[model samples]
Target: MSLMSDIIAKAKARRMRIALPEGSDERTLRAARILTDGQIAEIILLGQPDKLNAQAKTLGFTLDGIEIVEPVTSAAYETYVDEYVQLRQHKGMTRKEALEVMKDTVFFAAMMVRNGIAHGAVSGAANTTAHVMRAGIQCVGVAEGFKTVSSFFMMILPEFRGEHHVPYFFADAALVPNPDASQLADIAIATADNWKALVGTDPNVAMLSFSTKGSATHPDVDKVIEATQLIHARRPDLNVDGELQFDAAVIPSIGERKSPGSPVAGHANVLIFPDLDAGNIAYKITQRFGKAEAIGPFVQGLNRSFNDLSRGCSTEDIVNTVAVAAVISQAQA
Candidate 1:
């Protein structure tokens, strides 16, 4: 099955609760209907109930059993604000300021995940990436014992061979512009763990570079090499190698010719780019020229599930992103 189909199936099997913070948005409301009708998730919309209903009617949609909730009016609203005050007390936030911030749908949805009221949240349709991420970091925080928060794009390519073409995941493409050695290592580890959970495959991590092994030398190549060493030292059980060129990382002929005897070379299903410039450019090229289907820009490394969607996303994109967040919840479970 295609990655998205597999993702939908996985999400339905999990039957998690997904919080939609932008219920007033036509696309999100519609996506919630699809998720609810398909029985994939228990859809909870954060908005004014009456306005949500009226908006749905105007859009020719029937909300049916879908639930609409306004964050400011919720019984848990005060509790959330108090918690936020404590969470950000170091910032010198006042109760009054906290209350106003809590009213934001992004913060509300993230608090829901923090409180276990929802398994995950999907937002950023009507918000910027910065705002959504700030809410998540302040409320949900990063996964336990991890320092960096990164992202990945699940790239499903056309069959490479008969039966060996599993989907590939590209990492740090949409977040963390220029990572140092330690941060890069954290991203690789997070990507590997995420892949094992959502993709259901043993992760073979490839830390990408323009030079294979020590064939060439540059500061950028050194960073990948250092990240590789860090990952190997920290996670000995994970199969990974780095400072490898693109051709050596995926193609057997090139891999054997250059970096033979490496476990991950030519067999990598998860690729970690050296920096955002390379990763963002490479994934776009793959999507456009290679005709690969890119399924995510999922924010990874959160303790609970919360994701930022592209403001340019469609209703279908929102649906897929919700499924991705649900899948992340399943991994935690």
Candidate 2:
């Protein structure tokens, strides 16, 4: 089975509760219908019940088993507001601010995850990434031992040049515009952990740079080298190598010639780019020109499961993200 199909199957088996904050969006409603019909997860949509129902009717679908919650009218609304104030009180957030923030569907959905009302939350369909991520970071918080919350794209490549197809993960593609060595290390570790959780395989991480094994020298190459060292010091068990060019990281003959006997070189399943400039451009190029199927910019390193979607995402994209969040929830639990 394809990786996404496997994820959906896993989600169905787990049957976790996932919340959608953008119930007013047509794509989200359609995705909710698909999730319910397939028994992927118990979907809780946050919005006005009447408006959501009318929208579903206009879209010619039934939200038969889906639960719709009007956030402001729900019994937990005031409680959530109070708790949010406490959570952010150190930042000088008052109940007044918390009340207004809780009215937003994204924050409400994240609060649901925070309070265990739902196992996970997915948004960003009609919201900006910054807004969705702000809600996630503020409400769900970062995982223990993680200093950075990052993202990865699961790239499914087509069989080409007589090689069989396989899935690879590209990291920090949609978040963290520019990362220093420390943050880059955190990104690598987070991506590797999530890759293993979802793919059920050991991660071979290759930290990408323009120069291979000190063939050239620059601050950019130095940053990648330092990040690689930090990853080794922190996670020695991880199979990781760094300061490798793109070809050396993926191509067997070139890898042997350049970085011989390196565990990750030539066999890397998780590619950690130096910066967002490289990662975002590379993933898009691979998707458009290489004809690879890219599934995510899946958010990682959150204590609770909260994912973001592209603003232009399709209904299938939303369904897949919800499935991913469900699997992450199960794994975290």
Candidate 3:
């Protein structure tokens, strides 16, 4: 099966609950129908029930089996507000502030994930990345031992080195502009874990740079080298190599010539770019010129499975993201 199909199948089998905060969005409502019909997950959509129902009807569908919660009127609203205040009181958050924040669907959906009302949450369509991520971090918080919350794009290549349809991961493309060595290492570790969870395989991680194994030198190269060492020091079990150029990381002949005998060279499925400038540009180029299917800028390193979408995402994109969130929820559980 294709990677997305496999993930969707897994989601169907697990039948985990995923909350969608953009219930008023037409694309989300359509995707909810698809998720419910496919049994991918038990979908809880947060919005006004009457408006959502009317929208579904106008769109020629019925949300019969789906659970819709109006955030402020929800039975768990007061409880969620109390929990939010407790969780954020250290930052001087008051009950009144918590009440207002909980009224926002995105925050409410994230709280649902935090409180176990839903196994995971997906938002950001019709909302900015900053807003979606803020809700996730504030409500769900970062996972223990992870100091950074990053994002990755699951790049499904149409063809790679004569193989058809290979899956690779590109990290920090949608978050973290210029990461220090430590944050870069954290991104590598998090992406590697995500690859294992979703692809069911050990990740061959390549920390990408302009230089390959001392072929060149610069501060940027030094940063990548340091990040590689940190990954080795912290996660020695991971098959990771670094300071490699793009070609050396993926092309077997170039890899052998540039970084001979490196386990990750040429076989790297998880590509950690030196910074977001490289990662963001590379993923777009791959998507456009390489004709690869870029599935995410999915958030990682959160305690609970909360994902963000592009504001311009399609209904299919929402469905795929929900599938990914569901699978991640299973892995976390």
lDDT, candidate 2, at 225:
99
Give, for candidate 3, the lowest lDDT window spanning 10 residues: 156-165
Per-model TM against the reference: 0.97, 0.96, 0.97
lDDT of 3: 0.93
In model 2, where do residues sit more than 4 Å from their true spots?
none
Q: Tens digit of lDDT per residue, candidate 1, span 32-91?
A: 999999988889999999999999999887899887779988999999999999999999
Compared with the true structure, what per-residue lDDT tens digits does model 2 show for residues 1-333? Answer: 888988888899889999999999999999999999999999999999999999999999878889999989999999999989999999999999999999999999999998899999999999999999999999999988888999999999887547655789999898899999999999999889888888889999999999999999999999999999999999999999998999999988899999999888888889999999999999999999999999898999899999999899999999999999998899888
Write down the lDDT that model 2 would get: 0.93
Q: How much is the lDDT of residue 133 in candidate 3? A: 90
The candidate with the higher TM-score, 2 or 3, is 3
Candidate 2 to native Cα RMSD, angstroms: 1.4
Q: Number of clashing pairs, model 2?
A: 0
